[model samples]
Target: MEKVRFGIIGVGNMGRAHAHSLLNDIKGAELAAVCDSSPERLDWAEEHLPDNVQRFLSPEELFKSGTIDAVLIATPHYDHPPLAIEALGYGLHVLIEKPAGVYTKAVQEMNDAAAKSDRKFGIMYNQRTNPLYQKLRELIKSGELGEIRRTNWIITNWYRSQSYYDSGGWRATWGGEGGGVLLNQDPHQLDLWQWTTGMMPKRVRAFCHFGKYRNIEVEDDVTAYVEYENGATGLFITTTGEAPGTNRFEITGDNGKIVIEDGKLTFFRLRTPEPQFNAEYTGGFGSPECWKCEIPVAPGDGDQHKGIMRNFTNAILHDEPLLAPGEEGIHGLTLSNAMYLSAWTDNWVDLPIDSELFHEKLMVQVQNSTFQKTPVSQKALDVSGTH
Candidate 1:
């Protein structure tokens, strides 16, 4: 195919943004079709999209219409895996939105489908395209920071009002969207957490407050503590309640420390490794000599969501490697699932969590819920800065 004909399956806030990009930004992508359940969204597409771009209320019909060589599944979290699986089965390249799915078991099934198919599979882990995170991953992989001792991220900059949640009935319910904050706002940071550090925690113990800040049924506040295989620990704290919040990621190692905050990357380079300094120094009270330096990262975020789509399209056309493979999305979803499980059971959860048990518990929450969310508006909001 000279160009990858793309069909977007949802024209919600995120889906609409992606459609605009596929139409104007991505070089090797052609916006051939769009599918959405909302008639209003289809109306918007009819007015904005070109005459050649087909509109569909059913994704299967669009998939079989010979209009698209690939599919971008931009539906809700619960629909991601099943849609991707069906599209992959139709012999089309698949790119799904983040969090992979509401749970790992379903996402694993999607990955299985992708593995069986010969088509390219990618995810919208747009944050991976950021140069700051790329630089952090490089530093970690190069061992410039020695052994990781601790990882901490405070990403509470995601503040949402009640009206935001009221925009969609599926916004914060267990039956729809699954969970809040972690499932919605934190997927990017969660994915970036392991992607940059190159480590998955051995165990996760989390405290999550369901509807703590917002008048919703799902978690809006969370504080999770995790331990790695190498005895390194991590702290991930996030909430949608705080304004003037912080977005700081700090990693400390035996040799040095790295901090990404305020759009700047700073490294505190120790002259000697901390362990070596402690072992060889005669002075008991002496600390390792440290020099702070501003690490230079590439100027801008480098296209971000558009960059991921461009890479996805390039991978389909030129056999290029995907920047964010769909399978790797499970890593971050695992973290989110484990946190949810930990909070539900009030115990530490392990890596490669018991997907069945988690799913069962989540079903109980959905089936036996006393929570009811009444959406105030069905109108889509400008999601440029919100998500």
Candidate 2:
């Protein structure tokens, strides 16, 4: 086919951004249909979509209408898995928004559905397409950094105000949004954390701050320590209530260190450690001499969401390889689930987690609605710790 027709399932800010880019920017994309259950959202899309495109109130109707080749899901976190499954069942490719879903089991279900369909299945991990992140991945893969020792990220700059959380009712509530910053704000970061390291955590210990950001229920702050199978350690910290925050990540390896902050990715090439007899080296060993340097990277400018959308369409239409496959999405989801579990249990959770057990535990929380209050604690569900 000369062009890939797209059916967008939501018309909110991110959905509209994708539509605008697909219509005007993406080379091989064509706007074919728009679906939104909300009448106002549907009308807004109708007003914005170019001529010759169809508008529908539901995905089923849109899928039957046969106006597009693929479905782009931008719905709420809870609806992504089922919607993607339904779209894939109808022989349509799917590009789901991030977090994949609120739970790891949900992501697995979506993956299973996509596997059965044999069509292109992908998650919107737009951060992977960022030039800097892509470059970092290449560097680690090339062995230029030697053996990785430790990685630390302070991404508190993801500050969210009360008004932002209040913008949607299904945002911070347990019955609605499912989780907190881990669900909504940090999926991309978590995805990138694993992507760059070429590693998945074998165990995790987390401390989460629930109902800490104003009147919201769910965590707005999280501090997690991860141990990879390769023996590398990582520390991840983030919060939505802190202003004047940091988005700095430092990766230390046997040979050097890479630091990314303020959109400028910098490296510190190490020299040698000071002498153990020296005052700087008080027998406890000393630190290495590191020089700030710049790493070479590619140059590109465009929307990552649009880029991934174009990539998904190209992969479906021209046999192109997918950059962010649907299966890899489960890694981030598992990590997110493990963090919550660890925070609740105050114990180190292991990887390759038991999806069914996690699902069962979660179902109990869903049924216990006694904590009818917003932001029900995992502890409240008889889980573990509190922040």
Highest lDDT model number: 1
- How do the residues 1-387 of candidate 1 rate in per-residue lDDT, one tens digit apiece? 788899988887788889899999999899999987578888999998898999987777888899899998787677788889989989999999887988999999999999999999999999999999999999999999999999999999999999998876667888667788999999999999999999999999999999998899999999999999999999999999999899999999998999999999999999999999988999767798999999999999868999999999999889889999999999999999999999999999999899999999998887755443222123221121235
* Model 1 residue 136 distance off true place after TM-score fit, in angstroms: 0.3
Candidate 2 Cα deviation (angstroms), residue 106? 1.9
Where does the lowest 10-residue lDDT sum fall in candidate 2? 378-387
TM-score, structure 1 vs. true: 0.95
Candidate 2's residue-wise lDDT over 20-54, tens digit each?
Answer: 88889888889898887678877777687877778
lDDT measured at residue 211 in model 1 versus the true structure, 0 to 100: 90
RMSD each, Å: 3.2, 6.0
Model 2 pairs in collision: 217-375, 344-384
- Candidate 2 has an lDDT of 0.78
lDDT of 1: 0.89
